[model samples]
Target chain A: MTYTFHWEVPLQNLPLFLWGALATLEISGIAVLLGLLIATCGALARLSKHRLLRGAATVYVEVIRNTPFLVQLFYVYFGLVVVGINLEAFSVAILTLTINCGAYCTEIIRAGIQSIHRGQTEAGLSLGMTQWQVFRYVILMPTLRVVWPPLASQFIATMLGSSVVSQISAEELTYAGMFLESRTFRTFEIFFAIAILYFVMARLFSFLFSLTGQKVFREAWGQL
Target chain B: MRRHGRSWGWIAVLGIVLALAWTASASAAESTLDQVLKRGKLLVGIGLGAPPFGMYDADKKPTGYDVDLAKLIAEELKVEIEWVDTTSVNRIPYLLTNKVDLVIATFGNTPERAKQVAFTKPYSSWNLVLLGWKKDRNIKSYKDLKGKTVAVTRGTTQDIAITKLAPEAKIVRYEDDPVAMLAFEQKKADVMPTAEVLALKKVKENKDMEIKGLVSRSWAAIGVRRGDPDWLQWLNTFMDWHGGQGKFAELFEKWNGVQMPVALPRW
Candidate 1:
């Protein structure tokens, strides 16, 4: 069928969409950072000698990784609201995103920690380092460097998944496109624009993560 | 394996030819109305998430004004109804594709949509409003909506209205009415543009929100496939009878808990 295509609608709403893109970045950035913190604890727990600690951490990771992220988000946003714990949409988005990302991040970082040789721990202990110091300086830091690339990609996936939160009406980039499409009936133009914007944002985030990685772990990058 | 594959391919070809012949004969045998009558069922599409108009009850059965209306139509036609739960976005598509003989969704009649499907006479009218928390006295009108966050269902009548009224407002659109309501309830949005009836129900339950003001009014009508003059006339006649007998108003009040409109605009 023949039809006219208009790019003007999305063009005029460019500023609004850019603002939403920034929100998406902010949500993903904060969620990833917070997720890494949770993952560190989870990874350490799974490695702990105590059976309770390891079992609890393993259960947390398995349950989250097994279920769909959308269901988890809905449970957190809708299920909790029923009990009178009403969290704002943005906070709910970030909170669920972090917990969902944490499960996978735990697996990645735990693998990195397990891959470490026993000799490194022995050398640190021989040098009179305390257990906490050995883990913080010798094990955790190096394991993070080893898992950095995969973890960064995981964070990127989390950012893409953030689009699903628009179901809850969080004012993210995808929400902007849907809002514009509803107003103008220019579905093709708006979706095309949003697809391009998301592609650019994903690349931009990947580049930023690489730059930050280089700055934080110069020696690690050299060895890689 | 090769001999088995050859035999299976021939069977597939024969199956396709038989299916084509069956459809060709079926189309040649009767018109759409006659087909529906002969089949002893009318396929109707009804909106699922729009409460008071079309929504599922706690028992998981569809119960709403539209559902009741469709039931009446089916009774008059002396046929059973097979309902296809539809969304605002897909209701028209469902009718156009012949997936449903009629759409009793809260579908608005507009010239833009008329080109795609035929609209029977309007059965109901609902006014849209910008509603917010009762304590938020600052937002009295559309002017106060500037730079505020408003939630609306995507591609709905209210969504388009708010864009025209307050272009500067940050409009957050959801997939359906329920999600939009959830967003407003969670205080994620400063205001919401929704139907007056829907907003009133929420206000009465929450005791914290009020209808700020009117936004726009839309007439809801039944939709049918294009080029079906006979079927269209029958549906229009059914609505005329129902409306004339006051059954429409009775159903309206039964679902909305308010009096029906005195007059629905003739399309």
Candidate 2:
């Protein structure tokens, strides 16, 4: 049946939908931020000379990579209670997302760290630069160039994955659609609007990432 | 050359990491239900969109006939009701997977469904009712549906009714009931067929629609997972007492403005 484009939702509950959208963004953004921090640490650990640090990093990468994100999220969100590590729902959402995204970012960033070319590291070492200086000066900038796109994409994925947080009542965008459908009994309309909101958010994120990449990697040979 | 070597190493690292995670889950072999109930609330699986049966309110508190009704059942079970909102496509899988203890969502009883789960005797009955513009006086009966398009919820009895009674008529399948009601309001179709009480409620709530036919009644029952005879029997008896007494009838009239169908036998 044809329906009019409703100018106003009957209950005047547009704010719920908007609030849900913002929550989705916040969760995804927080996850991506913390995930980046974790990925750096894990990537560094993998490069460590000590077997324990390297082995631990290796185990983390293998386990997180193979499992489904849904299963992992459930484990982190629900399993914490078994160990008496009680966390709020929002905290779980952010934590699960950070862990899930971290493993992937570790792989991508490790490649960037490794791609600094032996010549550059040798050049830094010959100039009496410490290992730390070589890593920061030679490795960090080069790796950032190669990994920026995937990092942006990972953040975008975090945005979508935040929907799973609805299972734990994080009250994100999909949760808003759920709330609206319940109240309005306008299930299809509510979901349709939600899908549109997600689409717009994803597009906006991609646009921002593209702009940021241009600024960060403008000197890369591919651009020239 | 070194760049290619590192990329290949990363791939190997990725492979090993995944295998370890899989091993842990394989060994755990725990149930999702035990985990949920231990948290002290029964996580109910329901299609929060289907109204009068399930769904929530503007305040984000779940409120509907199904929500209220389920709250009663939860109170009796002495467990807090924690809703796990789902879609129509997800309900059965949710129950069989033990994501919910029971569903008070308005699932019509069918012989096919009996294979998958146990059902309490119907606490409510719903029928396909045709709705039209309030001023449209002539199109009040199912017989009037010939040669005209009708709007129905996809995959429901309304779709079946349209296909069976007026095969020549075009049927527009909306995703849910309220959408169909909106379609009827917009004159998108001459009539919309839905659960009678829901159609009546929408007609009263909206400025434009009217309910025309009571059509046919289908049994709406609470379902439990199959093989749980003890739970099943308890639910059947609970429904019988609460709904059989005048209390159920009084609530039905007070909130919904209709009586339980008399022909349906008690559990």
Candidate 3:
């Protein structure tokens, strides 16, 4: 069997792929930021004294964490359309990724918060710090330092999972690759290029997180 | 942490094992037509999101020529129609694996494909035409498409035809007709390979586009399992009876807004 490798098909669409990569980054980046915000609120709610607040947070985390991301994406995109709530594919993708990532990040951040010694809270309170002030000035920064690596890893996972958005025909990296592959019938070449691109993107996310961690957590880590 | 990772590893292994077992069980079923008849439903596979052939109308109901034809066949068989939405690529797999009794998708009949599945007589045919901006005088012939980018739906006859006709041209495949049309309209592609009817619709809808060149005429037929001679004969007979009553032409005009050919070719 003779095999001819045509790398030209995918390469010709490099501009389109790059645009798709940019979109992937934009979605994941926005989702990560939004997830972080939602996670903080969720973690806080889970720690609340009100039973209803804690229960609601627990349900959100458990439901999202247990269900597949693909299912969640379909429900948001297709199910919403059924109810006359039509959302653009890109918006739906960002919304779903943010919600899904928020659940995982909530648990991770909550764990970090719980890991801190009780004396730290006492230390801040005795210094005339309000509850919110203690969280912002003392507890929050340290908790982030403890959870940054795992949270960053989850962000990377979210970046990779963004590929699932193509199911709803979102113009992301995988969608671009699929479009090229279908036209050229060069499935291997297209997929190989996509695989390498995804790998580089994942590594890029990791590298950025590492640099941020060093800058933000240098004191909290306490040493080299 | 080590134990958690190890447990995940075990779960992955178990998942793969279960998936293989499930696939094996899924494929080794009995005769598809028998299954369909026994179930009292003609499990017909139809393509979704392909306009003028199979697509959802404004009412959000599946409508088009392929769907109408499938409904007729199911009515003749004295069974309820269960429309299983399929893609251009998965139609054959859906039939061979007993997922559907008949694939009435826009399935082009080709010799390479004949090895895998049985096809009935042609229900419809359309020329694969190149479409480009009307003002683009540079793209009048096949030679002009040497290095141009062309948009086509993935795994469709137009995609295959374009690949063979212009190996040098960059072809971008979309998931469906509407997406490919969007790519064309967005000027992401220099041209698009689509059915003649679809190309004409594009020209009528957008004053900028017109047919550039003809690739090849492709005939679409109902696909069935390879070993089912009885099923194939029944489908052919159904097509002939339906065609004689002029229902095919009625559907042709209803969807295409033009008269079909005097007779669709018989093989």
Candidate 4:
């Protein structure tokens, strides 16, 4: 109650916070892109006819989903050095984010793939489409339509969870907040500003995802 | 339009309620000294993460230099001690928010922090030094840290100092002392600026690392909320009394395994 609010602190450090926001977006953007690629491949592998491929994807999803993100981040940043794989903190952050979110995305995509009836594949084959063509035309598109909402949520979660990368000094929004808070000691004001910034960024991300979904599934956009 | 007006009315009501609550709390608030005496407890904040200064022992009890110092102060005040675990970044905020009556968590006295909290006379002192591998003989001064990744605990004195002194250096800040030290140990950083005692401990563990350069001599003091002149004066008197009696020196030697300085700067 004796505390005096320093509202000017966040305003004065607005540039740094913006820079941090940019870094947060950069990492989250790259991680989401790479995670999508990994998830698509992992989902396909999980449903592959070959035993080894399915087992590998299953193990990856199980292991990553079971472990905490912080421990995985520490391992990627610190533990990987022992094996002679030295990467910068930013790279380690992106790598860990991609790997961690890839697991969740893989499960999500897998569920979407499974939701497709076997009759759909049979219908595609009866129309004389190749296996790859059937997968591309008959399965993947509808699966994406079915899963876009949850997928968008997961992507947002990944973006928000990117805040944890500040632990490794990745210079993201949360790190900028910590840096400013350290110097100014205006904890409430700084964090209040940071929370608003993060909320704005997350909303921006959600908007972008919705736009992309609308464009990619133009006819089904309304249903989505 | 009706919904908007209703929301505006709600906002007004909420603001008035908050104002009443603030005034109620403000009126209920008393000076830290009076509050402690009246409550029969001294709420002391200490960083349990920093070792030798504050850390859990083998038995999982909080036993360190800062914890011991807090105990001494509580004993002197004839009150039961209650500890609030703090981190480097939260120390000032904790004091400001009245989460703890005082912080004894190896808090470095600096003008910037002094704006937010009152620091007592020095209870312990150490030089902030650049620590790196002994083989890295090229780093002798602040300029030599250019392009090198220096690890630091976020919000610690060394973090501020290194960032200010060697702005070009790639400073990687961890959340706390132990993690920063871990980053340094794991070779995630090329160098680290830390307290001399902590640097010495690291060097003892790994003979390859040594103190490369002294940045500044830092004094750790008890941090109380600002505007509590009476509380500050009482704590300063307690410091002077114990300091004259060599209680601080005794504790310093016991914890740090080095003789205390013959004279510490007083303000």
> Which is the leading candidate under DockQ?
4
In model 2, state the lDDT of residue A103.
88
| Tens-digit lDDT string for candidate 3 (B1-267) | 798689758866865675455446446345665666788898889997778899898898889999988888878877898789998755655665566888888889887677557788888877788889888898995568887888777778888888888899977665667767765776757898888887887788888888887888888888887666667887888888877777777888999888763358532
lDDT of 4 by residue, A143-172 (tens): 888888899999999999999999988889
Candidate 3, residue B20: how far the Cα is off, in Å: 3.8
Inter-residue clash pairs, candidate 4? none
RMSD, model 3, all Cα superposed? 8.5
Scored against the true structure, residue B193 in model 2 reaches a CA lDDT of 72
What tens-digit string does per-residue lDDT give for candidate 4 at B134-202? 888888766798899999998899988889899889988888887888888888898988888888888
Report the poorest 10 consecutive residues by lDDT, candidate 1 chain B: B21-30
> Which of 2 and 3 is the better model by lDDT?
3
Native contacts recovered, in order, as a fraction for each? 0.31, 0.00, 0.11, 0.58
What fraction of the true Cα-Cα contacts (under 8 Å, chains A to B) does candidate 3 also have? 0.11
lDDT of 1 by residue, B10-90 (tens): 866865675455345323323557778989999989998998889888999998999999999989989999989887765
TM-score against native, each model: 0.74, 0.49, 0.63, 0.93
Q: Which scores better on lDDT, 2 or 4?
A: 4
Query: Which runs in model 3 stand beyond 4 Å of their true positions?
Result: A1-143, A165-220, B1-16, B56-60, B89-93, B112-116, B240-254, B259-263
- Candidate 2 local lDDT, B204-261, one digit each (tens): 7887777787666677788777655666777777887887674556655555677765
Q: What is the C-alpha RMSD of each candidate to the true structure, in Å?
A: 8.0, 17.5, 8.5, 3.0
State residue B78's C-alpha deviation in candidate 2, in Å: 39
Better of 1 and 2 by DockQ: 1
